[model samples]
Target: MSSISIRKAVLSDLETLLELEQGVIKAERPLDPFLGKGELNYYNIPEMISNKNTHLLVAIVNNEVVASGYVRVENSKIYHKNVKHGYIGFMFVKENFRGQRISNLILDSLKNWAKENSLKELRLDVYSNNTGAIKAYERFGFTKSLVNMRTEI
Candidate 1:
């Protein structure tokens, strides 16, 4: 841990973010093996970078990116009580950088971003089998909010 810093992600960081995303997808695929391998750019980075309602953050050590995450303001369906919420996603930290509080920095950054956007609640979807991530999220004060179940027909 040599002076880790969390900063807003910029368009110039596109390549680095994509590289980290590759590692994240590979690491998480086992949790959702049914999905197999596929591209996962559900939220466009460039668009998010330019969107005022989204905050993309990166953790860096000595100016080199070691981890990243983002929180975006989302609108719920008309039927939901919570109309607006912060959706955290695309979190990743390099293997060598684990246990260094990098995720905390990312989460703190997102918390501030969410508050600034006047969001009262935050939500994220995780693969049920990703116990490590579940524990990590729990350490950050997040608890199980919902569950989705399915089976092959």
Candidate 2:
């Protein structure tokens, strides 16, 4: 098997990253009912790449971008002890690349970046029914801390 390497995403990586973002939305639409039907965007790639508070990363294999994710620095809630934390999102690994622990590598790098920035906590939101993703994050040492509830008004 070819080795996987993780690197910071650049503006040139935008095309592949956009497709990967669609992949994520496609996989998640069934798990979420509130998503819009056409051309939905969950992130701003160029701004993210240029933002000092965000770290966008892509996973490369055999000179191709196959997976992508990002972590952004966010202010903690006023009640929280820490002033800031890393908010992880857009974690999508291509279908062909699943089960290879590439996500773990991405998480490790993001965690390191957060620590280097003196952020004491890392947090992310996962679909409540996405058991596979939940298990993966659990295996990576993340504990369940919140469950956002919603209903039709």
Candidate 3:
């Protein structure tokens, strides 16, 4: 076991983050049939790092990035109780680092940032069939809220 540290992501971390992004997509492709085949990206690293509303974070062990996640302030729906909430995404932990609670540390930091910025709630989406991820999120205090359904016409 090695010491793990969490910090705000910087532009210099982009390359490693890109690799982690591929890890996330590869793990998810099997669970999501709607995802396009071939290379795809779910985030803009530079913009995310520069955006005041988003808090991107990375976990490092022995100076190597091993996990990553982010939370962004977003407007709640009109029917929702809160005015704004933190939308979490891009959660990934390298396969070698799995089950070590690195993701929990990232989530803690994101949750604290949301609290400091006055966000009342935090929300995220996970593939319903990704039970492993869902369990992890649930253990971190997230509850299942909504289920989205789709049909191909």
Candidate 4:
């Protein structure tokens, strides 16, 4: 059992982060085919890395990137217009690292980051077919706030 450490991602970690994003895209595309054809647009790696409202956490095992997740603050446009919520996304753990509680560690780090940013609530979206992730999020005190539906013409 190797030691796993979680920390804020830096510019020097961009290459590893992109690689991890590739892995994430590969796993998620099938769950949501319309997600595009190839690698995900992780928005802007540099901006995400430097943004104060966004926290990117990387999990390293023996100095190698094994998993990552991020949480960012977002404004509420309606019911909670006065507050900002924390949205968690880009969660992925290497295949070999599954079942080792790596996801929990990443989630915890993201939650702490949200708290530090003064977010009122934390939210995330999971594919309906991804049962494992859904269960994990539930265990972390997340509930199904809404359902997203799509139809193809």
Question: Which of candidates 2 and 4 is the stronger one according to lDDT?
Answer: 2
> The CA-based lDDT of model 4 is what?
0.87
Query: Each model's TM-score, in the order given?
Result: 0.91, 0.98, 0.98, 0.93
Across 1-153, the per-residue lDDT of candidate 1 in tens digits comes to 499999999999999888988887888777775664568754578887888888999999988999999998999878878889999998999998999889988998899889887888888988888888889899998999779988877
Candidate 1 residue runs with Cα over 4 Å from true position: 38-42, 79-81
| Per-residue accuracy of model 3 over 1-153 as CA lDDT, tens digit each | 999999999999999999999999999999988999899998998999999999999999999999999999999999999999999999999999998999999999999999999999999999999999999999999999889988778
lDDT measured at residue 73 in model 1 versus the true structure, 0 to 100: 91
Alpha carbon lDDT at 149, candidate 2: 95
Off by over 4 Å in 4: none
For candidate 4, write residues 72-125 as lDDT tens digits: 889876777557899899898989889999989999989887887777688888
User: Which model is ahead, 1 or 2, in terms of lDDT?
Assistant: 2
- For candidate 4, give the lDDT of residue 37: 68
Alpha carbon lDDT of residue 145, candidate 4?
75
Clashes of each: 0, 0, 0, 0
Q: Model 3 — TM-score against the truth?
A: 0.98
The RMSD of every model to the true structure, in order and in angstroms, is 1.7, 0.7, 0.6, 1.5
**Candidate 2, 34-124: lDDT as tens digits:** 9989989899899999999999999999999988888999999899999899999999999999989999999999999999999999999
Residue 41 error, candidate 4, Å: 2.5
Candidate 3, residue 22: CA error in Å? Answer: 0.8
What is the lDDT for 126 in model 4?
91
The collision pairs in model 3 are: none
